[model samples]
Target chain A: MAFASALKCRECGREYPTDPLNVCEFCFGPLEVAYDYEAISRAISRERIQNGPLTMWRYQDLLPVDGDHAVDLQTGFTPLMKAPNLGRLLGLDHLYIKNDAVNPTNSFKDRVVSVASTKALEYEFKTLACASTGNLAGSVAAHAARAGMNAYIFIPADLERGKVVGAAIYGPTLVAINGSYDDVNRLCSELADTYPWAFVNINMRPYYAEGSKTLGYEVAEQLGWQAPAHCIVPSASGSMFTKIWKGLKEFEDLELIPKVHTHMHMTQAAGCAPIAEAYEAGVTRVRPVKPNSIAKSLAIGNPADGYYSLKTIQESDGDATIVPEDEVVAGIQMLAENEGIFTETAGGVVISGLKRLVERGAIKRDEVTVAYITGNGLKTLEAVEDTVRSVTIDPTTSSFEEQVLNA
Target chain B: MGVTVRIPAPLRRVTNDQDRVEVDAENLADMVDAMEEQFPGIKERLIDETGSLRHFVNIYVNGEDVQFLQGLETAIKASDEVSIVPAVAGG
Candidate 1:
């Protein structure tokens, strides 16, 4: 049974039927999935969730989709591992890393696409589409292939080679537009009006975004039904960061967890830090910028949820940090070297921002902090290409000893 | 050969359900004023009370976001295609 009640406008209190609509007709505000929490509270139980599949679908009661036609990729339910090594280095006592990099597509996009594709199939849509930075393209293609739907993925032309090849391997009609992600998004928005395809992030976004709340659900459940004090998340469009907080709050309201006191810190690359810039300037409006960051996945200049994310941070008493372009690779190296978790540039932005937060005394040393590692490092190898070093030796143990151990 | 203004679905009610409307104007600011003259209550939706474009709405001139160009002062010529779209988020 789907607990979602209606598609409500975030700005205006207008509600629409559960359809493939993203913007409110009256206010042009983004439409969000409003659920019948009373029903969810009655239906959901810790034991019921535990007995379900070891995936994001476990929280199906809170999600917007019915379980009848789910396009299951076995996504989500990622490991919430204790990051003792990195925590010690950062001067935090209890630190955890919600490693979403281990998802089906090696990124958290699988979670959203899983829900969106399932809804698309339920709506009887023949095609799946999105305007992706990198990760979402591959995810949409994979999910479309799984559900036997035609896929049309649009992306910026300058995206990473791994991401480009990743989507292409899934046999989707991947269109690399010669413009930024924002430009590609605008084109897709226009296309969504003309085409009948279910653009996951454009037309089918209300249901698609609900998938992110599962991340928050999984974290609290994994941590014994307790919300972390601080959650540092890398923000591109600020959707996931906001949704994660919403997830925690929903759990708290449902009496599934204690009152959520999670300080939702948002991290962004310095090259494209509109939300951080707004926070630093003490302004409510987010000014867009042309993205110039290696953390390309989090490079949405005109973030749709920028205002909502800023509001979430202020309400949570959390802070936003901007990581310099130079430190992104260093952040990636630190996590990989210490915790053996190879995360993409977005994760680097989170780690680097977390370090800055710690150094400035913003984050308490004893606070139970969780930094989200959203994507796999393998997809963005170019960001750390120079860091790849090898010991050149004649294939012999004597050469290894002489060149490495002796030297 | 006036500029072609492509109206999105949300604003089509104000445009008499017409998807595309043609108007004559020199710049985006004038174009908006012209649109207001043709279709009342649109300028308020596109622009906030502070006289800036609403954060939820984006105006693109010939496939380029007007914010990147000259914002409200962006120049528009004959046969130019202007699109008004609601901002949608995801990555």
Candidate 2:
């Protein structure tokens, strides 16, 4: 049973009916899914959650949607593996990789789209729409197809070819806007008001953003109810970073865990890291910049939740860092070589950010750290296209001996 | 001084479908007031009831964000080009 009472304004104290609304009409502040923790504390239990499906819905009471209209494609409940290889390399005792790269859409976006699509159905929206950098477009299209809803997915024109085909395969009306991710998002914000569609990250955002909490829940549960010492998450819109923090706090509030003192670390690619730039500059405001990065998935220049993300990072006493382009490539290669887990560019950012944090002594060597791997490498083969090409040899033993054994 | 504000498509309804409008105001807060006088519902869209500029709406003067300047109190000048760009988020 959903314990969600209403959608409450994040900036203002006003509450509104749970509807297909993103920002508050009165204050224009983002609306969030407000839940009754006291009621949830009583209604939910560990056994109850364990008995549910092996998907994100396992934490059903915590989610805002009803079970009846849940649009699911087996999203979430991904593996939380103890990365002994990566840990040893980083000189950390405990290192975990939240391998969400294996999701249905091969990205963490499936988690959010599942909830948003279901909530759209609940609200009787006929279409599922959104402006994406890449990952979200594919996820939205797939979810829309599953729900038999008309889908209109928009993206920046220069997105990865794989992501373009990924969404196109789902038969959504895909439109490529000739601008940055920020431009696409701006157009979607306007389109969301004009069209009667459920733009997952716009009109249906409150429900969509809540889906990220499952990542936190899964980590805690996988860790046997112990929160990690540090969680390094990549920031785009910065929603997931803050949501993970909220998730841990909620788990403790619901008595699922005794306590959580997790330091929320944020990762960003240097090319488009407005939040990190602000943090480094020691300013409370985020200044937007035009993005020029290979990590296209995490390139939301004017992040909607930048201010709040800054606050969450500061309040959690967390540290954030941005990885250079070369380090991003190395991070992906390091993970693939060390743990056999191939990840997208955004995952590389997380790994590299963790590396920088460790080197700078911001993230300690002894602390238990979980770096969120947000997407699969296959979705962004272009990023590693030139880096890891196989050596060509003649089909003969002599050729192999000369190219490999002799070398 | 008179300045031209390029309103985004979302807020054009309040401006009677005019994409750009020239308003005489000394500062951003005064510009908001002047725009509200011309378009009654524009202030509610741009600012919260508490009167602070909405976080999602970014106001820029001559290509520089007002936030880096003096925010709503940033002074204006004649021929200054003001643009109201909404924050782009997702992905």
Candidate 3:
């Protein structure tokens, strides 16, 4: 039931046949999966979708691969929490938190890697590879192991030790480049040219990125097949923000959701906010920065999808905001205190930007708003440990009592 | 027309890590051509073999994507700025 039709270039409107390719040969634009939407729309309905599995595979009809051999590790269908407490604290009335921090690898990247690996298996690729920051490295390694593919992942050497161990434990050939994530990505792009491996973010990216659309689908469905008034998403390469908007539009095209007004706001760490910097100055071009923030996961100084992401925000009449590093840590702690979501630094950027949006009177209090929390806090505990309070206690019963009853 | 072009971090290898470069051109395409003349090997880094801008790279003129405005044909004035940004795939 996979309704893939062709691979279309995002920059230029040229179309190519289905293949493990991500760029247009003619225009060099990024390629995306085109589908037989009319056929899919005729077959899938709200009832059909609701009756399906609780995971992202529920929309398998719209996805790229077929057969039961999906590289599924229970990736999607995460909770869409109604954050009245969080909303109240942020001075908003209707706020929803899409908590993807609980995924298998504690990041929403599990969703993309799961699909990419599955498609690679379908393509019979013997190797799985990607140029990652931190989260995708772990997710790709885990999925490649499950799919019986030889996984070779590359990341910046200074990545958090926790993330390094998290990926290494999965038994992948992890390469550490002593430079920025962009440097690692450049090397991988060169490697992809020579190696016969299925580089997830390079060749298999068209399908991999499609997995993010499920997040948008789930949000709309969870809200009764209606788009929210606004959405604030953290951006790294800027793919997630654009894909979420695409997901909402696809739902509307299929008549599964009503035509609704949803502004897509983008959030970034101030230390690495090239996209936000571009947007605030009313420019469409992003100026890459050397990422120097604790929010390492969001420290993509040269976002691949920066232009399109900025385009999406502007087209939707939305805005992009950059939160300072201190506020990013505070945002994580605040979300945990208000709604019990232990989010990572990127999530902190999102929450802090959401607050900024509200304070600026950009997002109205009564409007339905959703803030995307993409990763878990545990992986980034080092970033906020100094800022967060720790409970100190003694082993002795008397000391424990004294500490417990401190007045 | 003279415009200041900002070089992205990833492409700094070709530009000698100079964050910004100044060039003279009447349009986006002319500006890019001027950049290639000023900084050798940069066009290859920014554009593919097919002479199209790479998917990972974007050029902006005065804060607007050249793609949405005649792409390489986008007009540029003396006071306008051109920026070359590549996608950073870190997080």
Give all candidates' CA lDDT scores.
0.92, 0.87, 0.84
For A162-215, candidate 1 gives per-residue lDDT tens digits of 999989999999999999999999999889988999999988898899899999
**Fraction of true A-B contacts recovered by candidate 1:** 0.69
From the highest DockQ down, the ranking of the candidates is: 1, 2, 3
What DockQ does each prediction reach against the true complex?
A: 0.73, 0.39, 0.17
Better of 1 and 2 by TM-score: 1
- B7-79 per-residue lDDT for model 3 (tens digits): 6544566678787888888887677778889788766666766776775676767555566577777888889
Model 1 iRMSD vs. native: 1.2
- Give a tens-digit lDDT track for model 1, residues B11-86: 8889999989999999999999999999998888788778888879988999887878999999999979999999
Q: What TM-score does chain B alone reach in each candidate, compared with the true chain B?
A: 0.96, 0.94, 0.85
Candidate 2 per-residue lDDT, tens place, A297-383, comes to 999878888988999888789977988977898999989999999999999999888888888887777788999998999889899
Candidate 3: segments with Cα more than 4 A from true spot: A391-394, B1-91
**Following a full C-alpha superposition, what root-mean-square deviation does model 3 have from the true structure?**
7.7
Whichever of 1 and 3 has more lDDT, that candidate is: 1
Better of 2 and 3 by DockQ: 2
Per-residue lDDT tens digits for candidate 3, residues A159-265, read 88888999999999999998878667766765776688988888888888988999999999999899999999999889999999999999999999989589999
Rank all candidate structures by their lDDT, best first, as comma-separated numbers: 1, 2, 3
Clashing pairs in 1: none
Q: On TM-score, who's better, 2 or 3?
A: 2
